[model samples]
Target: MFINYVKGLLIGSANIIPGVSGGTLALMLGIYHKIVYSSANLIRLKKVKEDTIFLTMLSLGILTSVTILAKIFKSYILDGSTRETYLNMLFIGLTTGIIFKLKQEIKTRNNNNNNSKKITKYFLFLIGFFTTLSLLLLRTYNISLDISEYQNKKSIKYHIVIATSGIIGGCAMILPGISGSLILLSIGTYKEIINIISQLNIIPCTIFGISTIIGTGITILIIEKTINKHFAKFLYLSIGLILGSILQMLFTITKLNVKPTLTLKISSGILFITGIYINRILESTKK
Candidate 1:
C-alpha cells in the first residue's frame, strides 16, 4: 500500500510537468497494467475490496502531489530559467530510460513471433513517433487566450467550453506521450484551469473534474480492450510516443535558450544520469 502511494506520487508529479505523461510514468513504475485494468473493472465490483483500496490510496497520492507541485512549479520553477532547463533534461532522461525498458519487454514478447510481425511492430513504432511529433509541432503555434476574462461570465457557452476542454485533456492524460496540460494549453484553457484550481473555485472546478473523470474512464476502457487484443502493437506505439515526447521536451528547452554555466551543465548532467539510474532501479525491481 505504501509502495502504491509512492508510485502514485511520482506519477502525479510527472503528470504536472508540461512534457511528461503520468501514464508513461505509471508504465515505468510497473503499475500501468494494474491501473488500466482496475479502471476498466471499476464499475463491475470484481475484486472490489482490493481494487478499491489500491485505487483509493493511489488517487489520494496523485491528488496530493499534483496540487502541491502545480502550485510550486507554476509560481517558481516554470520561469524559463536554467532550473527549468535542467528539470526538462532530467525528465527527458527518465523518459528515455522508460523507452529502453519498454523495448526490452517488447523484445521478450516477440522472441517466438514471426519476422513479419516483428517488422510490423517497428513500423507501428515509427508511425506513432511521427504522429506525436506532428501534434507537438502543431501545438507550438497555438494562440494564447485571455481565460481570466471568461471567469466572470456565467454564460452556459463558457461552461461548455471548459467542460469540453476538461474532457479532451483527460483523454490526453491516458495517452502515453501526451500531456493533459498541453492539451489544455492548446485549447487556451490551461491558465484558466490553473487559476480555478488555485482559487478553489468550486463550480468550474467541479464541472471540469467531473468531465475529466468521465473522459478518463472511457479512454481507459478503450485502451484496456485494445491492449488485450494487440499488446505488442500497442506497446510499440506507446514506446514511440514516449520517445517523441522526450524529443519534443528537448526541442522546447532548446527554444528557451538558457545559457548553461559550467556548474549548471554539470548539475544537469548529474540529474540526467540520476534519472536514468532511478528508472533502471524501478525496472529491475519489477522484474
Candidate 2:
C-alpha cells in the first residue's frame, strides 16, 4: 500500500509536467499493467477488494502530489517569460526522449509483419499524427477552447472545454509517450486547471478531476482491448501524435521570449539535457 502511494506520487508528478508521460513512468515502475487492468475493472464495479485498495492508495498519492506540485509549477510559469521559455525547452527535450524510446520499442516489435500490415500501420500513424496536429493547430490559432476571457466559470463553453480537457488529459495519462499536461497546454487550459488546484476552486476542479478519473477508466478499457486485438497499430498512432505535437511544441517555444541572456540560454540547454537524461534513465531502468 505504501509503495503504491509512492508510485502514485511519481506518476502524478510526471503528469503535471508538460511533455512528461505518466504512463511511461508507470511502466518503468512496474505497475502500468496492473493499474490499467485495475482501473478498468473498477469502472465495471468489480467486487474485488484488492483492486479497490490498490486504486485507492494510488489515487490518494496522485492527488497529494498533484495538489502540491501544481502550485510549484504554476509559479514557474508565472515567474518570467524567459523562465517559461526554459521550461518549454526542457519539455521539448523530454518529448524528444519519448519519441526515441517509442521508436526503439516499435522497431524491436516490428518483426513477423508483412508489407500490407506495415502499410496499415503507417496509415494509422498518419491518422493519429494529422488528427493530433490539426487539433493542436486549432488551439494554437485560437480557434477552439480558449475560454480565458470568461469571468463566470459556469458558462457552458467554459464547462465544455474543462470537461474536454479532463477527458483528454486523463486518456493521455495512460498512453505511453503521450503527455497529459502537454495536451492540456495545447488546449490552453494547462495553467487554468493548475490555478483551480492552486486556488482550491472546488466545483470546476472537482468536475475536471472526476472527469479525469472516469476518462482513465474508459481509456484503460479501450486500450487494453485494442492492444489485445491490435497492439502495434495503437502504438503507431501514438507515435504519430507524439511526432505531430513535437512540431507544435517547437513552434510554441519559439513564440516565447526570443531574447534571453547567456545564462538563461545555458540554463535552458542544461534543462533540455537533463530532461533527455531523465528519459534515458527511465528507459535503461525499465522493469
The TM-score values for the models, in the order shown, are 0.93, 0.81
Q: What clash pairs does model 1 have?
A: none
Please provide, for model 2 over 1-287, each residue's C-alpha lDDT reduced to its tens digit, 9 standing for 90 to 100.
89899989988887887656687667556687788788777778885798999989999899998999889877766354776777667766777787777777788987857999999999989987786577566656766455667657879877777788898899888976567887787777888898898888898888899899778878899987987788788778877876775665566566665676798779988988987898688677764
Worst 10 residues of 1 by lDDT: 144-153
State, as a TM-score between 0 and 1, how close model 1 is to the true structure. Answer: 0.93
Residue-level lDDT tens digits of model 1 in 1-287: 98888888888887777778888888878888899898877856678888888999998888778777877888888778887888888888788898888788887886557888889988989987887677676667765555666655488877887899879878888888877776676667877777677676788878988898888888998899989999989998998888888887887687778886898889888988988998999888877
The best candidate in terms of TM-score:
1
